[model samples]
Every structure is written in structure tokens, then in C-alpha cells.
Target: MLRSVPSKSQILRYVKGLLITWKLRWRGVDCEGRVVVAGPAPRIWSKGSVKIGNRVLFRTTSRRTSIAVRGDARFEIGEKCFINDGVEIDVWKSVEIGPYCFIGNNTRIADTNYHEIDQGAGPRVDSISIGRNVWLASNVTVLPGVSIGDHSVVAACSVVTKSFPDRSLIAGIPARKIRDIEAADDYIRPG
Candidate 1:
């Protein structure tokens, strides 16, 4: 059997991953175990805290992933989670991402409005909690004060402005539950 040679892009990605790994370690990120960073390096600006669990994968080939934690906020990415390219996470209060979750490309998760709407009003700040095994499709935007329950799936381009229960199939702008995942006839529960 003949062995295949690695392509130029593959080699470049490998090198980039190694460099990103070192960069993350140098930046004092709390990485519990091995973390894989593919493609370009992520832009992480933290003044508070960032915790990344074991075996987390960050795919940043198409675009870079940016994470910002301001003030005394906390940001966490649980074990076995897959974060696709172009994902942006802004935490002014707190953002907790549970294990086995899938964040599709270009998804944005923010816990702050970033700016005040009224002249004297302060920016809205809140916490975001994403439960285990949740899947947020590409272009999904999760606004402030939203909690997504375990095993829930939010469709692409959804704008989530509220909380969703476990096993829900959420979609549309200002996301509403399309149906219960387990209740669907074609739904197959993972063993």
C-alpha cells in the first residue's frame, strides 16, 4: 500500500495549530487538557477569566474566532465541544457553554448589548448559559440573558432572544420552539 503525502494546505494548518496552541498556553488560558485549534489563531481578549475543558476543538479556517471577556465576567467552553470558524463570544457578565456542544460557523453569543440605547441608560448586561449537547447552527445569534437547555438544536440564522427548554428544536428570528425533538416522528435519540 502506498502512503499519501500531506498537501500544502494540510501542512500549513498543522503548523498553524501548533502555533495557536502555544499562543493559548502563553496567554494563561485555563485549558484542562489537550485543545485543538485549526486554521487561524483565535483572538482572545480577556480581562476576567476563561476556562476551556478537555478535547475542545476550534475550527478557524474560514474566519477567526474572537472571544472577549470584560470586567469580572467569566467565559467557559466545556469538554468535547466543537466551535466552528468565525464564532464570536462576548461576555460582560458570564457565558457558560456545556459539554458536547456544537457551535456552527459565524455564530455569535453575547451577554451584553455593548452600548446604551438611551442617553442615560447603561448597556444591558446579563449571563448566557448553554447546556450540554446543544447545537447552534451557522449565523445564529444568541442575545443577552438567554439560556439554552440540553440537547436543544437551534436552526441556522435564528435570533435567540429568550430561554429554551431541553430537547427543543428552535428556529426563526426571536427564536421560537418549532417542536420538541423527542416528540418528532423521525427523531432518533442518541444512545
Candidate 2:
């Protein structure tokens, strides 16, 4: 039997991933499972709580993934979630992502506008809950206080400003439910 060996690039990638994991651990992130960085390391700035479940993969290469939380905000990601390159999540209140979710490249999930509205009042901060088995395509933007139901699919470049029910296919600028999703298992990543 012949044995296979890891290439140099693979080894380098592994080392970089390890370094990133260590940095997250040092930042007081409550990680319960193995979080792997498949691309470049992600930048996580946590001032409150950051919880990650098992087998969460972060893919960041050309565009880096960034997760930031300030004040009393909390960020939680469930098991078997895949976050692709350039995905940015900024939580000023709370953001919860359920299991078996696939977040495509360059998606932005924010719970705050990052600054005060009307130039005087405070920023609108609310919670974002993403249900299980949801697939958000590339360039999708989930604004504050939005809850995506389970087994839903948001098409590419959609801006989700409102919540949608389960098993829906959402698309377009303001992200309306185009139709109901019949059945789909394509979001599952094989072990």
C-alpha cells in the first residue's frame, strides 16, 4: 500500500489555520468544536461572547472573513456551518446561526448600522437569527433584526431587510420571497 503525504502548500495552510485558531482561543471565544480555517485566517474581534459549535469551517483566502462584536453583543454559530471567503459579521446586539448553514462568499450579516441614524439618534441594533439548513448565496446582505427561516435559500446578491418564513426562496434587492422551496439537500457538506 502506498501512503500519501501532504504537499508543502497544504502544510503551510494547516499551520496558518492553527495559528488562527489559537488566536481565537486567546480572545476568549467559547468554541466547543473544531473550527478549521481552510483559507487565510479570519479576524475576530470579540468584546462580549462568541460561541461556535462543532465542525465550523471558515474559508478566507483573497478576501478575509471578519467577525466583530462590541458592547454586550453575542455571536453564535451552530454545528457544521461553512462560511466562505470575505464573509463579514458585525454583531452589536446578537446574531445566531443554526446548524448545517452555508454562507457563501462576501456575505455580510450585521445587527447594527455601525453608527447612529439621522446623525443624532443611536444606531438601530437588533438580533439576527438564521435557522437551520439555510443557504445564503454569494454577495448576500442580511441587515439588522432579520430572521431567515429553516431550509431556506437566499439567492446571490440579495439584500435581506425583512424576515421570511421557512422553506422559501428569496431574491432581489429588498429580498422578497419569490417562491417556496420544494426540497433540497445540496447544502449539506459531506464528511
Native-structure RMSD, model 1: 4.2
Per-candidate Cα RMSD to the true structure, in Å, reads: 4.2, 3.0
Best by TM-score: 2
**Tens digits of per-residue lDDT for model 2, 10-118:** 7887677566666777889877756778766788888989998877889886798999988888999998899999999999899999998999999999998777869
TM-score of every model?
A: 0.85, 0.86
- Once superposed on the true structure, which residue ranges of model 1 sit more than 4 Å away at CA? 1-19, 183-191
Candidate 1 versus the native: TM-score?
A: 0.85
Q: Positional deviation of 156 in candidate 2, in angstroms?
A: 0.6
In model 1, how many backbone clashes occur?
0
- Pull out the clashing pairs in model 2: 40-60
What Cα-based lDDT does every candidate model obtain?
Answer: 0.88, 0.88
Q: What is the lDDT of residue 153 in candidate 2?
A: 91
Candidate 1: Cα lDDT at 7: 100
